[model samples]
Target: MQWVSLGDTGSSCPAARSTVAAFRSWADSYLTQPSDELGRDGPVCPYVQPSIRRSLLWLAQVPAADPRPMWVRAIVRDALEIYPELPTRNGSSTSVLRALITVFPNLKDHTLIDEIHAEFKTKFVERGSMLGQFYPGCDQPGLWNKDFRPLDAPLPMLVVRGMMTTDFPFLLDKPEWADAYVRKFAPTLPAHVRSVMVGRLTSRPALVPAYEVRPDDESCSTSS
Candidate 1:
């Protein structure tokens, strides 16, 4: 995990400084609101306000890491055009997140990067009795099926971190996403982890075909 300086707001325009304040405000109280729509309760979110406030700037201005151990290493960006003028979405909430990957696709522990973006998207679109307000472009139903998700978020933001081996089960239902998962993670996974993924993937006919594994193929070998 990277060291995170919680209360530091390096240099910023007056406007950006204020935006950070607004974000922190939301993170403190608004995020804690009990939303039957979000399945969120009054308990403060574990992500914490300071982390969200400084993360956008941190991407550009991350100083050398401190020599001490840290609790969490994460990246965040505001897509609302509200603060720090980070990045405005052309409609898709995920545009900023995907753009980040396009710019720096390879990072240490690629798992964290994939995990955060993928989970956020999934959580936003999820529609049960629990979550319904996560939709992004409310006026534009063309962006997503209205029957399922209207796609709206109170604050447009994306948090990113490495993907974890435990998250493979969630990706198995999405073919393109699953293939990307295999490409990014299969190369670095522990031998045991790889073997488990191969076993699980072979039974998931809906998603396994994209990896194109065969009994004789070396590319998908668990030993590799």
Candidate 2:
């Protein structure tokens, strides 16, 4: 379960070499470039280029030929444990750009990918991280374009990254999740954006003004 740099080819899994190659190709051709389908002005993932340049992107391949749910869960838990130790540039400002992509090369049961994502998402979010599921024929649509499946990828995989201010959409519907988001980013968000977030919360919690909190303190004890 060791995480490797994108160029590493030392894995023992039979498909690991090819699967990692495919991921690298996809990343260079699709993720690092902008697409009309995205309905936006930048690369598919705006952080990807910087992640690559800073050498903060790492990949791990699950060796199971036919992965079981319990095993995949275990792998995901391992990944969560490994994420915080990943390297970054400029500290917190660029740490959100860091990513760990865990690939399931031989998994054919794509539905299990979704299940694993649902099971681990809460834990990841509470730790100030986001978990994303990606697989072929994935139907999860892009935020800006309904027809675009930004989550779709050639192989089944889960990705983890430090949550960013732009993740409000994912947090807005759930009160607890929204509170976590506010506690993490409230000090950095624009006033209008904070207003919009407050308006969208289902049950708004009284947020202590950011000024009252120490600048180095990223978490708000009162918000939780």
Candidate 3:
């Protein structure tokens, strides 16, 4: 498989060799331990701030799509982006998500994108919140938590990929989002799939029913 060096910026998936090794090392170290700061039991990047910094830098140029699809593969690749230069006060997880959503159109797959986003939110945000709290009583994430530090990783990052069919539930809830979703996914749907979606969207009754029925007048039928 052809690979590009980090920052080389040619085609895609261009992670440098050293950067990959370094990321492996950092991931092994940080991911191996539980993060006490956030009162969580998972790898916390901030615990090894510098290591995460270097990894994020490498991720900036590495392509998010896996070669299997681009070329055959088992693991799905997800894109990672960082906004390090933003002003301290201006940086937030919301900002990262906005940036990610803005770029979603260009990517090839979005299922992984949603998965990655949810992963971070669950691991970092929901782990110790009312969703995860106990004994003291169920409280909202912000108050009553020890530090309220889910999105506060060592770096601000967003994972993104092409959108997927499962996204319809989220998109179809709103008229505007549904409209946009139709425009985006319709062109790619099979004729039958498109017909089914259009049928549902337009609130048209299905043409076929489960059981056979007499044509208009059952009395007209003659018994053999």
Candidate 4:
């Protein structure tokens, strides 16, 4: 029999070409498989799992001296896309704020910080309102008696006595409701100073009107 090298015969040698063709056919058959047969537990495909941490770290490490890079914002938005659940956590947004503050000290300026704080407060108020919609307990009226009067006393004593007379009964009857009220109320504050003032007012024993207890209402009066 005459021998023909597979390379020299090029496309014309059936025998030599058949063997090469057969090998390729077999290799391709062995490599290709039904998608269902592939194990799901194997490492996630690279195209599916982007390196979120590395990108975030790189953004964090950017030189503070340079003006805030446009890429950092893009990376942040990308990271949020990769992990959409991040904003749901209470501290997660605050952590991002702290990171930005570190990277851009200009964020600490009173005007800028106040603006950001106001924006966050607005978001929190909106969230609280949404929560109130789902949980109507957030909007319920005071269960205590309005006519009940605390004894006349000094300023602090009068306040305490008044709360005991009006707000304490309901708060005591429903401590969980009191707590929910506090949480729903606190987020409406636009500034730390306003928050402090609101906290002082809410902490006193005073009956907040049902209408005034809406998620966004920060002004609660001592009287019903």
Q: Rate the local accuracy (lDDT) of all candidates.
A: 0.37, 0.80, 0.35, 0.28
For this target, which candidate reaches the highest TM-score against the unseen true structure? 2
TM-score of each: 0.36, 0.83, 0.25, 0.21
Model 4, 85: alpha-carbon shift in Å?
1.2
| Model 1 Cα RMSD, 1 decimal | 15.3
RMSD values, in order shown: 15.3, 7.2, 17.8, 27.2
Candidate 1: lDDT of 201?
A: 75
Q: Which should have the higher lDDT, number 1 or number 2?
A: 2
Tell me the RMSD of model 4 versus the true structure: 27.2
Q: What is the lDDT of candidate 4?
A: 0.28
User: What TM value does model 4 have?
Assistant: 0.21
Question: Worst 10-residue stretch by lDDT in candidate 4?
Answer: 153-162
Worst 10 residues of 1 by lDDT: 126-135
Per-residue lDDT of 21-91 in model 2, one digit per residue for the tens?
88878888999899999988998987787777776778888867678778888888988888898766676
Candidate 1 residue-wise lDDT, 116-149, digit = tens: 4544444322210011112134332311223422
Stronger candidate by TM-score (2 vs 3):
2
lDDT of 3 by residue, 116-209 (tens): 4444433222111101111112222321245554432222224222234434544433344455556655677667756655555555223323
Q: What's the distance in Å from true for residue 51, model 2? A: 1.3
